[model samples]
Target: MSDQNVAARTRAALDAGEGILRLAPTWVPRSFLMPGARLKLSREDLYALGTHRGGIDERWFSSTTPAANEGAPPDEGLSYVVHDGAKFTLRDAVGAHADELIGPALNAKYKRWPVYSKFFDNLGPIPHHMHQSQEQAEKIGLEGKPESYYFPPQLNWTGNNFPYTFMGLEPGTTKEQVRRCLEDWNKGDNGILDLSKAYRLKPGTGWLVPPDVLHAPGSLVTYEPQWGSDVFGMYQSLVEGRRVPWELLVKDVPKEYHQDLDYLVEQLDWEQNVDPEFKANHYLEPIVRTGSEQEGFVDKWIVYGTVAGKQVFSACELTVLPGRSVTIKDPGAYGLVVVQGSGHIGKLDVDSPNFIRFGEVTKDEVFVTHKRAGEGVTFKNTGSEPFVSLRYFGPDAHSDLPKVGDYLKVG
Candidate 1:
């Protein structure tokens, strides 16, 4: 389509809330790569990129007790640990691509990750609290209510905490507990229910958990791509070794939303597997599409492979055919991490070679590209083998489509 036509359609879609925002930048034109240029990121760099506030403080880890009834007050020291959910934004890295960068692809990537001062309006440190009963309070030698700490809901504002460590599931944990806990909390009447029956993610598969769902990705290594918000609710707290009072937590939730909490919980999947085979690879799924056909941006995907609706995120053990790259038409800002292999992106004139290399990709050290309407970018795999990488777009790509099946599945 003509540039003007594409822009017009995109505007209409945004107006009607129906356009798809592509977040990956797997494909860039060959002309963009600079001579001897290759971009890369290390494990440390990846952690640094995701660590919005800074590294985790050892004091918070040592002083905080895991027992719920320890009667410990909220440790002010713990407030500094900021979760990545709200810290990272597209706007923070725009100047790197001050020039046009490239063409259509560059424009699309920029729109998704805009250069705004504040990526999100509300960002704060998650507070620790305990739920207490009058009886438990007496046992702990407390005066009134027994303080019980509840687990924080996974992401959305649903009630339920899926215990997770940094790398994977905690040792000595049974899959049954994972399933049962999720089910028990999703009782279908504003209570938990069994989610074992719902669709589960396969290796190399990625699924999008819409807002307000009682879903947890289990303790596993995940490159979570989400909207620009860190706001969430807690239901249990293993950190404090206590269950948060339902009354207090529920008080903040809207009555109408709370009334249907049970029904929402009932939709969780309980019969999930814990084996590495199930969690090791990429899992791609469909998510809701936003924007318009003319706006040049269209459908969004929960990508785990070469093409995430035109952008590329992680491509471990994946192949991008020679002389062929995925073109992202979405007008949102986007990023790339070369987990494996070597490649070039955007217009050849402004293109830079990736230097840092790691098993996984991080947002830090990523090459940002800016594209205009009717223009797009591509990723060329220079290596003899398949090129592997991961990418992400701006907040505009967030959508409400349920189930990974709603997006494309690439094996």
Candidate 2:
């Protein structure tokens, strides 16, 4: 399609929704992972993409970046904005209206929506893996990803297989030990987890994970807000009796260093991996925004903290009492997902979906433009239960952003 056509449709969407655009669910599948069946996607549609493509385990929100899954369609992970029975990819909308949609500052620096959030529900634990840092990703013409996770209490009713994550290596672990694990990749079960300590995953909490950190995430439906990049390298040799290919370990590494054990070992951020106080540095708990608890609504910062000292992303959980309403203002645009109850957000209807079929449209998700956010949007809880929503922002969106351990300081 031509730029003129996209721009026209984008403008029409913005005008129709009063600066907020409803988004279609963007489901993604991972060939190696088992779906936890908690994302509200209908059981009949879990394998809608065909079993060969694996189960639909993830649902991305307000995304402009496509999934890097091999053989995936070009628009696999991209979100589409729906209006007046017509739709266009959010990527096209942002490309046509970057300044007004995402804001001028972000558009000037990133030239696109640089961050996105997703709900990834896995049955067991993911293999130990690490995302390349920007310095390393630059080698492959992609950006580094720094992600944060929040395990929503509503979605995680049951911990499927394992409810503990192995994050970073034990403080006394040696580089040679890790090198040996890689050398033993061809052997069954490389035993990388033996060198790391596991933390019991808890609901209503989160963690800030920077690039180059090794993590084997546990069985929980995680709400992740992160930089817009899909670059990662799995380090574990086997998971759940399934042998992980060696190609996955060096997929993001340069072609020349694919077989170089030492170079591959150097990919890890050694100091971080060996940090004794890893939890103290990365664990996060919801911090109530000061003065945000009014008679009808309350807001809590669910995801916050800087990545490499830069405010790359943040998220908030807003709960409105039934029969009440609240108006909120923010510094920038955001992507929102309604998790519980029914409500009205500005000019759009919002409801937490119970079960969604593949290729179905939902009122649970929307993108609020920067202008509408700054002007303030009113949300009303029209259901019998409390209306709950989760919204995530782009870089530098919060001037008073909370730190990792700020919740402890709250009285």
Model 2 lDDT at residue 160: 96
- How well is each residue in 9-114 modelled by candidate 1, as lDDT tens digits? 4343222321212121211111101111112223243333123323211111101111121222332221111112221111222222323322344345433222
Per-residue error (Å), model 1, residue 335: 2.6
Per-candidate TM vs. native? 0.37, 0.99
lDDT (Cα, 0-100) at 240 in candidate 1: 24
Candidate 1, TM-score vs. the true structure? 0.37
Clashes of each: 117, 0
Best by TM-score: 2
lDDT tens digits, residues 80-173, model 2? 9988888889999999999999999999999999999999999999999999999999998888899999999989999999989999999999
User: What are the C-alpha RMSDs, in order, of all predicted structures?
Assistant: 17.1, 1.0
